[model samples]
Target: MAQINLQNVNKSFGPGVPLAVNDLTLTIEDGEFLVLLGPSGCGKTTTLRMIAGLERQTTGDIRIGERVVNDLRPGDRDIAFVFQFYALYPHLSVRDNIAFPLKAQNLPTEEVNRRVMDVAERLRITHILKSNPGRLPGGEQQRVALGRAMVRQPQAFLMDEPLTNLDASLRADMRVELKHLQHTLGTTMVYVTHDQIEAMSMSHRIAVMDRGVLQQVDTPLNIYRHPQTLFVATFIGSPPMNIVHGRMVGARFVAGDGQFWVELPPAARQYTQHDKRVSFGIRAEDITVGAPGGAGMAGNVVVREPLGDETVYVVSVAGKTLTAKTPPRIRFNPGENVSVKLDPAAIHLFDGDSGRALLPEGWSKHV
Candidate 1:
């Protein structure tokens, strides 16, 4: 069992260049699955490489279990790195590809064969052991790569978007397989992916990053329901959270365009200033749209998109575009006026200039 820790880690391409990872500090418990999730060039992969000894940090300490391994080489790190592409030799058979790492270590021939067949059996690829890499399907090729990684019994696994090359259906299938594999092996895993669905489905906890900075770290449910920053609130959702520029006025939220207003309880005043500029945020699913002249904002539907699972409507409320998600069976044509009601408890308030969640201490109960 191995626990990985990174403390005040920083990396840069050159002396005068900007940092790739800035003051990153994180800890992964032994046998835990930690996912580094972010978009391209956000430094997630770089952080994984630093842990695997493939890249050096400008300043920090990387500890594997109880030992500092900053100067160690990749091979000596006791961690297996899985690439996005299948790195198998085209001429080698599946069994040979799985056994190559053991052979390189000069283990006994019988031992190498035993480990290879064992991993093949575990991966359910024993029937294709003799097939060449080029002859295998994409899913089977990935299994071969994983078999190779598993045969080593490394302290941890660092995967850099290993399912990126597969089709959508195959990628989803592999996600289930990979999660089960991690559970069975109980090895420390630092997985890198930009796909939120993959991260949400597989990780025990997610580390969200953006532009070389850590945004928030939490469970998938918490990340979805209670985003702490504007960036995270906007990035984590599919239709994205609707944020309207507004101000708090005597128990009322008035929009910047003077279109409509929302009644706020007097108790919420402590969370906002009098007529202070603020951002009002609510998820698409939390808003209900219907006929006008009710307890909500009156708006005209600009467009309706049917997504089978649900219908998304773009509504013009006081000249501001707000997206609302409705039931799949609900039908609305463009130019239809609708009343939009936001779940009172679901509303989010963010500071206008800093874009930070405005929550009173002990705010969990309210949320």
Candidate 2:
């Protein structure tokens, strides 16, 4: 396995176009599963392509192992790229498709057969080895594509949303299988996806990007619990984080419109600047919904969405709508009054103007 590194990488199409990737510097440890995660047009795919040697960067160095590979051909990069679509050859049998790379390398017939069978067996696609890829199901075709990549035994695997074409249930199954496969193989992998769930569930670490800028890189849990930027705060969660426009008044956070206030926790007080504009953030799961006129801000439920295991409540509080994710048992109807309590300990603070997290020193110790 090899470690991949991109130092101060920048990609630009031309003078008129914006840089696709800007000053991106990141390192993927040997045998680590690192995911490039962001929404569309966020330069994630471009970054992946650059690492694969498919697109050359306009600036900076690209290193795989100990080699500077900026000018290397894709085939010479020692990386296997799994495209979003199952790019299996329609006319080739699954077995032949898996053995294609070995054939290109002029490996012995016996060695190619052995490698193909091994990968097929590991991927559990041996039963379909003789089947033509054109007749296979989407998931099976995907396996064929993955098997083809795996049969090569490349130094690293770069995947671009490889599960996007599968159905939701199949995608979930593949996520588990992929993670297991990565663990078993212990090869370096760089996966690109806009699906936060995929990134959160599969990656050892995630590099979040926005508008060509590298926002943050950390473990899935750390990125979720302690986002370093406003975009990350709202982007990584399912229901997203609930943010309130406000400013710090001493140790208290007062809403911009002067509707409500929350006392900052003592641990966070040292980081707060009196009269500084900031955004108060809390996850939907962190907001507690209680009986009306209880020990919190009173709000009227505007909408109730039942999501089987849990119910999402959209409450109108202080002229702002905040979503609360509560247990299905804690039912609340629209138009009903409820008390919404923001957990003081779970709150996140960000600079209102710059949209950057305002975290106290040693904050990672808590995460």
Candidate 3:
């Protein structure tokens, strides 16, 4: 296992095109599963390629273990890259595909055969060893691709959305298998993916990127609960955090439309003294919906989404739409009147203009 480090790394296509990665400095510890997460065209893939020596950084240094391998060829990097498409040879059998890398190095036939069979058994693909890539299921094909990478026994593994092509159920299953595989092998892994679930579920630490810039690097819980920026607050959640643009009026945050307000607790008083125009954010699950006559902000339900175990209700309040995730049994029809209660402790406050969280010092310390 090896620790990978990138220091002051920047990549650009040319003058007109924007830099793909911008002054990004991060470290992937030995035997760590670090995930690079972001939307499309966010330079995640570029960063991974740079680490693999597939794409050279325009400026700055990349260090694998103790060596500054900025000029090393990809073949000499001692890292294996598993592509999203599996990239297995169509004509070669699963055994042959997994053994191809060993064969190229001209290892003894017995050694290569033993290694291939071992990986196949570990991946539970030994039954399909004689099958071609074309005949295997998406999950099996992905396993074969992983097997090929495993047989190399490289210092680290870099994957670029390797599970993106599988069906939803299959992808879910493979995620478990992949995480277990990584734990068993104890190899340093740097994974790139846009799927929040994948990043949240599999990573030891998540690096959230946007427009080639690193947003926040933290555990899944920290990223979700204490997002450093408005972009991250809205990006990491499933239904996304519901944000209301408002101005502070004494201890209450009044919505922009002047139709509704949420009372701020004493803990939030310090943030409103100078910054009146603030953004109030709350997760869908943090808002409670009550019966029409109950004591809370009144709103009209606009949509009801019944997820298996939970239900999401979108309500229009103060000219803004806010979503509330509630128990599945708590049914409310569209146009029905309801009361909404925001959890003061769970509330997130941010600056309207700068879009940065205005966390209280005590709260910040806890986070």
User: For model 1, how does the per-residue alpha-carbon lDDT over 1-367 read when each residue is reduced to its tens digit?
Assistant: 6999999999998987779999999999899998899999999999999999989999999999898999999988888888888788889999999998899899999999999989999999999999998978888988999998899999899999999999999999999999999998999999999999999999998898888888888888888888887777887888899998888887678896666677765556678877888888889999998878877888889999999999999998877888999998878799998888888777777888887888542454554
| Candidate 2 structure, TM-score to reference | 0.96
The numbered model that scores best in TM-score is 2
Could you arrange the candidates by lDDT from highest to lowest? 2, 3, 1
Worst 10 residues of 3 by lDDT: 358-367
Q: For candidate 3, list the clashing residue pairs, or say none.
A: none
- CA lDDT, every model vs. true structure: 0.88, 0.93, 0.91
Tell me how far the alpha carbon of residue 61 in candidate 3 is from the true structure, in angstroms, after superposition: 1.2
Cα displacement (Å) at residue 292, model 3: 2.4
Model 3 lDDT tens row, 1-367 = 8999999999999999989999999999999999999999999999999999999999999999999989999989999999999999989999999999999889999999999999999999999999989888888899999999999999999999999999999989988988999999999999999999999999999999999998888888899989888889999998999988888888888886667787787767777654378898999999999898887788899999999899999999767899999999898899999988877788898888888888742563432
Candidate 1 lowest-lDDT run of ten: 358-367
The collision pairs in model 1 are none
